[model samples]
Target chain A: MTKLNKKEKELVHLLKENARLSSEDLGQMVGLPSSKVQSLIQSWQKDGIILKHTTLFNEEKLESTHDTIRALIEVSIRPEKKTGFDAIARRICKHPNVIDHYLISGNYDFLIIVEGKSLQEISSFVSNTLASIENVRSTGTHFILKKYKENGIALGTEEMENRILVSA
Target chain B: MSPGFSHLIETIPSSGIRRFFDLVASSKDVISLGVGEPDFPTPWPAREEAISSIEQGLTSYTSNSGLIECRRAIAAYIEERFGATYGPEKEIIITNGVSEGVDITLRTLLNPGDEVIVPEPNYVCYAPLIQLAGGKVVAIDTSQTGFLPNKQAIKSAITAKTKAIILCSPNNPTGQVIPKKILKDIADLAENHDFWVIADEIYAELSYDEPFVSFAALEGTFPRTILMNGFSKAFAMTGWRLGYLCAPQEFIARALKIHQYSALCAPIMAQYAAIQALQGMKVVQDMRRSYEMRRNLFVGRLNEMGLDTAMPKGAFYCFPSIQKTGLSSEEFALKLLEKARVAVVPGSVFGLGGEGYVRCCYATHIDLLKEALTRISNFLKKR
Candidate 1:
């Protein structure tokens, strides 16, 4: 029912392909003036289709080179306090660098997977940032020692098939 | 936008295939044969062409109808490949993918309370999208006819409120192709009954042994058919989101208004790459040969195992009955993943007629096919 007009559709198409495109560049891509592009972006921001503009940084390039710091945290709450827990989880999720978070099952009220530079950063965040919140009682952290795969694909052939590790 | 925001959204069903894939991804050590995409990378030349187009500042928007040269190339390619002809300028509308083309066409054609007679088990999108368009979907199960719609059943399914019938050849779960005679019969039915025929021929070029017949290509059916297709399957350009709708000039005009509003146009770089793909007929032919090989290998082995697969006349999948194993298709698929470590789609995901079957996609490596079949054999043995 929220049908995008021609210009809005053009805006969405550009954003879907490259969220990094500058408003001026996006305008150029859709044959609109720079000012018009800025306006469209503003409207899109309000409409929520252009949910947020953020960088998808190359993790290897970050100062925290340890990929092992990645952990999935699950928190469980009482059934009656589901709304309060959800609010608390949403607050944690607004952090600038959080990758993905989900509301999941089996003993967990919330599942938060965040990438950190080191275990200390994660520990400090849990102690100071996460634990400080009200109605947040328990948390489980699983340090990713080796990532056989990430996202929806295998990281390498070794993940797809069991291959013997050859040492030099 | 309106009071029915939640209600309207709540009525449409989420994609079953998408849901299954998410579950499989979360599970451990599952070798997925569930994905419908070709495992092959986008052809180097097409990739290079797209990269160069961006580099040369050809990234700017083309007309809403799409790049002129691309549209012309599509017209020429369709004429040469399927013997269908249309004016590229006024009759073609580029879309994000065949999914979007299907979505836009339904939304544009259906008024409130209109009926869409869809043949099942078929692709997952048809019914949900039609409902989202404020139309009611009347599903006609095609399982009894080996996934091809019978003339009598289709005739019986139609009513005065029936506005259109969605036809998917080389169908999703069953891989059944409507033969020329049957195609013509359906076309004649549409003509006599005064209903639109939304022909989804996305797998047109992927037809293995049998030839594909486009609904628009049939004599006297051109006026009422809206031909939908995309480059994802045939050209291995799934990520690019380049698809199009070819219809009569009048319908194209109306659809373009919706297209212009909903998607404006497809990606500019993808359109440029499609121009290259059209020029490169060899690329289409090569992919066809490989998919045919994969389809043949998987289906052939399944039959040898006595899995009872109906001959898949087109597309790169085989729907084999698992009734002998004494499990529902969902149960069979879950057991296979947990035991054999191979992931496949349960046929029920496609809709009503697919309950006892599983759709195994073979658009993967030959070695993977062999391994999956071996796993299948072992799973059957333990039962």
Candidate 2:
């Protein structure tokens, strides 16, 4: 991978902090014209420098009925002839319960993060859907107990203290 | 209802920067680069600790100096980070903010008509606070020296009546850090001339290019340096009203008396929050990293738009020369605000040597900064 220049790295960092920042603002920050900043952002998106923009919901603040259960499931898989773990990983990820799946270098071939309405639902999905797959060898499930942080933001029940509109 | 105010209070000019902030507050659809504080909220752990402390009924007033435990944390933090040592009990007095710390230190140290060498363009509060404390402010213009005061200029400004020199590193408005060699020279001059060094290191943690050097940590300068710092800039705790003044035992003892009669002590809950902040330097580092990115972007953009701005080594402000636009600093700032709805402080508000520039704070949301810059660019084009 080619290393990003200082400005590009700063652009990435700023976007990471607040992706809602407009092109004009990004331009002002990195010393580029708005047109130039827009083009650069386009190229970044095209080149996979920017994968996707997503919102970070403060789940604790929301009034919701379902308390979702999330677990990290480490999967040891039997490699197929040509595709190795890719085919099996794709099949497992096709399940709607799988929020994220990553190929790994550890003892396990894949680390998958799965979420469901309840612990029983996740367990049944793992047994009926994930384990029933042909290439699946074994699985180790570790349920999340608490979320201290997510998406570079702290997950907490506390509301942010209101700042003065302007200060010196 | 019509009681007369003090003559001294009447004479002191209202902060020009605050005037712009007021204008910003009242106006709609305005993108303000006028504020000096950070955009980030205080880190969660610190705020959480403060809430918990209050819930646990730790709301009583701390000692005149501050909580001993908080003082100890500050002492260890200073020693570990900046290689400076001070006894937490005798050398540090927690104040409401650096504002109060500066106020009381001057009141304690200065007699009437004593001169204080203040380098400008600088922070707005220093000169007025000097006057309020009965000290004559001798402002040495640092415009020609990249906003870093040279030793010769400082020495030339000093006189027998000179009581102290006020220094701000990673300075406000200009965002320049004094070079270490020159700072050392200034320290040496303080030693030879027997003047106090009041170093405002509130922005110390925000330095981008180099590790911040505490004036008190310098050889032979520890005895004479009054180092002031707070959680305002670094930990985004401005509203928490927590700051400290650290000096020699005798100096602190005198300053403590002034603090006792006036503000008494910093907020107890805030002090507990500060202890948590000291424990959580990682949060400070994260915030500093964000500020560094913003600094580079803001400074670079200003320069690109034909405004000659010094790359800020620390702090979140960028001082951009508006002379090229053929407008007075105030005229340029007012025009920008009136036409573009983008608010920035006229640099002259910071005092002498500041007339040809404007101070743009980059601590706002990046989107607002971009919109402000776009408006500024359009305004410049029309000009």
Candidate 3:
């Protein structure tokens, strides 16, 4: 993939800070004219460098994260001869509390993380949902006591860590 | 399966807000500033009405456009609130919340290769839905103008393929309300260019500052505007899955056709309850006042923490710039959650212009907010 050029990179940086930024303010940030900034953004978007604009919510307000417990669930499975694993995965994904789950490699057939109201709820799911599956084996639940970072960014880390860190 | 099922489904990334909450949910003892729903329960009157409807056996489908009473109530409410008028029979169609309203409108309006003008730092749904509809999205970054769209950018982005523009006021992520003058300008452009305006004003009722003006409120502009709103935000009815779309009679007629085949109708019990919600403004007003208090306290603490937070004029979110920390928004969010056990969303999750900022919702309890603030300050100092 082609890296963003100096001006383009600067435009992306400003936009990442506030997607609602005006082209004029964007130009000022990138040292370009408003028209140039607009054109540069248009070009970058056309090339798919800028994927889509969105809103990042304060989920804490939703009380969706109130109990804040992370547990990874592993399910061992043998696919019912007719119905495939994809169908089962989709069924499990439909559960509201299953935030992120993946069909992974190696020993564990599936790696899942869920948010539940309590430890009992998590265990109930493991016992009822996972254990009850026809081709299922026993599962392991790893409760995440801490989350250092995710999506390539570290929270509470110094700003230096966020940079690319080009060596001398 | 649709021909492009994989391609279509893969296009929209999981909401960054949801991702942040995932991290927040991991830490058992964390104080969170990452939620977006109202703190209040669904208004008692509304809940009672829904329960009564169910008790009375009002569970069958009403109509493709939804119950007549609900539509009339919506029309009356909009007229009373913003002087926007619509013929309930022809101009209104209730949907399965604003989420479906947005999804259905984009699906109905855009064609492959069409372009949509979306003001950034707005709602997360607009862009992805536009993409799913096979329309190209042109985002006009609006952070510089106090989170409002620039008229010049709107004009410049217009092309033969421009299908519509989406306006969200008391906007999500950034709580900036669209000024009436600016809205008029946008309406003028839409009129000149012959493109529709899909306005999502779900937070109009919870605005803390000035009164919100509906794009449909402007005379002659109603024909080209589809106003989408819901009871979820204001009434604390997120689980209800009910909303309504008001557009020109012809468009509603068309949208209803698609809606009828798609969702059938908003949940019957929820629709019955929504009717009661509209009839009771006093309850809505009380909730608004409470949100106003939370918004003030949350925004105030963010500013006091030395973060450059924009004082939100409406909604419950405060978009604070964390650039001084020299940390990218994601890094700040992750570290704060892990080290301080306080979770807030990074700005980059919103879009291209969201890098150096983080969004914190004031809808949480005051004690939680204070604790989150303490963790935030400590994290900043250590950095």
RMSD of each: 22.8, 5.3, 22.9
Off by over 4 Å in 2: A1-90, A96-162
Per-residue lDDT tens digits for candidate 2, residues B1-383, read: 88788999998998787777777778888887877788878888999999999999999999999999999999999999988899998999999999999999999999999999999999989999999999999999999999999988999999999999999998988999997898899988998999999999999999988898888788888888999999999998998989998889999989989899898889999999999988888878878877776776677777888889999899998899999999999999888888999888898988889999999888876556667777888888898
TM-score, second chain, candidate 2: 0.98
Q: Which ten residues in a row have the lowest lDDT in candidate 1 chain B?
A: B289-298
Model 1 bad stretches (over 4 Å): A1-168, B1-4
Clashing pairs for predicted structure model 2, backbone only: A25-B370, A29-B297, A31-B301
* Reference-based lDDT, each prediction: 0.79, 0.87, 0.80
DockQ of structure 1: 0.01
The lDDT of model 2 is 0.87
**Over the stretch B1-383, how does candidate 1's per-residue lDDT look in tens digits?**
56556688887777667777666777776666787766666666888899999999987777888988999999988888898888999888889999999998998899999999999998888888998899999998888887889899999999999999999897886878889888898988999999999999988888877678888788898888999888988887877889999998899888888888877889999998888877666867767766665665577668888899987887777899998888999999888988898888888888878899998877766656777888999989888
For candidate 2 chain B, the 10 contiguous residues with the lowest summed lDDT are B364-373
Q: Kindly report, for each predicted structure in the order presented, the TM-score of its chain A compared with the true chain A.
A: 0.55, 0.84, 0.60
| Rank ordering of all candidates by TM-score, starting from the highest | 2, 1, 3
- What lDDT score is found at residue A54 in candidate 3? 80
Question: lDDT: which candidate is best?
Answer: 2
Q: Calculate candidate 1's fnat.
A: 0.00
